[model samples]
Target: MYFFLINLSILDIGAISVTVPKSMTNSLMNTRSISYTGCVTQVFFLIFFVGTDFFLLTVMAYDQYVAICQPLHHERVMNRTACVQMAAGSWASGVLNSALHTGNTFAVSFCRGNKVDQFFCEIPQLLKLTCSDSYLSETGVILFSVSLALCCFVFIIVSYIQIISTMLRIPSEQGQHKAFSTCLPHLTVLSLLVCTAWFAYLKPLSSTTSQLDLVVSILCCLQ
Candidate 1:
């Protein structure tokens, strides 16, 4: 649990740092410009950390599943070696996904003005600036991301179902309460994270930016 928590903390820091620092500096300096290279780097790390957060949340769900549903085997199932491997795998996957997105996005010709409406260089906003049909490649990336997120969402749902079923069979009110107390907050947080991400990225793109876009962008930045 500690290992997973530490990794999650690191992921959160990386994710927030990617955009917040530059956004803050821009605000303080009263400027709203980032170099093309810097924008690309931000896009890459932002995707990386967001992907890592998704995987880490899934992992933590699995950890809670084991702890609540199969308490006797919790230590063995979530051992140090397993924790390290999961953390490494999450980071590795994040990097790969981010690389694919960054490469595809930057390959397009940016004929449109580079003024991103959002405070940061979000992929959707960047896509808006592309002048070529090659932007379809980035659309493919979004589709792939949605598919992956759906799979993880399904996994977490199944794990929670099993967890709930196990808790119900515990026979003691206090025991059930204890079990739920541990899992409910995790479930709530995961739901908020996944739903916000899906809504932000999977929704139909508008030709003109709407108020909803800004709201969704702000929601995505929230902790």
Candidate 2:
């Protein structure tokens, strides 16, 4: 889980790095201009990492569920081979999802308009700028993105529900306390993720340029 989290952090850094430096440079120059290819690359890599993180988080939640709920078979169920397979599967799924989304995104030509509103290239934000008829692409992207997000959310919530229920079954108060304490770090990370993600994608896209958005973006990068 830690290894997967670290990879997600690095991918976040890469996504942020690709966009922030250019945005800062433009701000200094007072010209919000990004090259056509640069913008495409930015959107592609951003999608890649975001998808990758989603899969990584889902895998981590599953790992936690197994560790907490199936202690007797934890080692057998999550042996080194199984753990490696889970990691590989997450990585593979992320790559495929990212590629699919990115391909759909670029299928709609941008014409000559390269003025992106947000500091980073987001899917919805980019779609808004396309000159081509993007109804099909837009719908597909939204559904794809939402499905992954909802799946991750449901899995995480279900895992926690089972975890909490199991903890409540402990006979001793100290055992329950310890069990709950084990989840504190994961809970903190999940809260931050949900909050930042809500602001970034759930809220109005027009509001992403605010200071709050930047702070959230920065926080995500730090993770």
Candidate 3:
């Protein structure tokens, strides 16, 4: 748990550090700006850390699920080997997915319009700002994003379902309360995260009006 928490802290720092300071600097200077290389680097690293965070949260959910719903077999199920494998898989997937997205994003050229709408170089925002043709790149980005989102969503749903089923089997109200208490924090955080992510990225791609953009922009900054 300590190791996992430390790594999670690092992931959180990486995710925010990639964009926040730069965004702040731009804001202070009264400029909406990023260099080509800087933008690409930020985009790649941001994707990597975000994917890592997703997998970490999913793994944590599974860990809680096993510890709660399968207490009798938890020891054997989440032994040292299994724990190591889960961590490795999450990190490896993040690296590979980020590389793929970065490559695809770079394949789209920017002829003139280099201004990204959001502070960070969001794939959708950058693509829209690019004067170059980006049908293929945009399609690829959508596919990758959807795949990751669906995978995480399914795992979380399954985890919660199993959790609820197991909780329902408890005979006493006290037992049920104790069980639910352990998972409530995770559920709350996951709900907030999913809602915010959907609102930020899954909204209409063509709906980047100034007011809506500022609201989402502030949320992103706060996050």
Candidate 4:
């Protein structure tokens, strides 16, 4: 689990660093502009890191399930090779997903002006600038991404159900309390991340306003 935790920490750092430094520079310099290349790079890395973070979180949920519910088999199931494979798989999938979204997002013609409403080159905010068909294509890609996240969410939920059930069977009050303490916070964050991301990305843009986009985008990125 420490291995997975390490990867998560790196992803969190990378995700925030991708935008925060440029943001701080802009704030200090009193300028709001980023070169086109810089914006593209930001979108790519942000997608890559954040996408891997989500996958890593899902894998960690499974790690916990195995640790708590199948302790006897934990070593065998999550041996060093298996752990490495899982981590690598998460990163590989993140790269593929990021590449798909990044390519599709920039492929659209941007004529609505380059003023991104949000802090970074967020896919949704970038979509707002498209005069071409980014909405149609990017929506498809975002839905695909969202669907994958939901699948991970479902897998985590099922794993936790097994975890909680196994915890309930622990016979000792202290054990059950300990288990609940561990599970509740993870579940809470998972719920918030999934809900906000789905709402922010999938909701109809026409019905939404820039202010709402700004707020939701902040929630999506910060979490």
lDDT, candidate 3, equals 0.78
Error of 4 at 214 (Å): 2.8
Q: Among all windows of ten consecutive residues in candidate 2, which has the lowest summed lDDT? A: 200-209
The 10-residue segment of model 1 with minimum total lDDT is 214-223
Off by over 4 Å in 3: 217-223
RMSD each, Å = 1.3, 2.8, 2.2, 1.9
Q: Candidate 3 lDDT, tens digit per residue, 84-120?
A: 8888898998898888888887787776466666778
Candidates arranged by lDDT, highest first: 1, 4, 3, 2
Tens-digit lDDT track for model 2 on 73-154?
A: 8779888788778778877887777777777877887764565556666676676677746647766766877787898899
The superposed Cα distance between candidate 4 and the true structure at residue 32, in angstroms, equals 0.7
User: Per-residue alpha-carbon lDDT of model 4 for 1-223, expressed as tens digits?
Assistant: 7898788778877877888899899999999999999998999998898788889889889988998998899999999999999999999999999999989988888988778766788887778788755469888888888888889988998998899899989999999998788777667766776776777777766523577667766676666
Q: Pick by TM-score: which candidate is best?
A: 1
Which clashing pairs does model 2 show? none
lDDT of each: 0.86, 0.74, 0.78, 0.84
Q: lDDT (0-100) at residue 144 of candidate 1? A: 93
Clashing pairs in 3: none
Candidate with top lDDT is 1
Q: Residue 98 lDDT in model 2?
A: 76
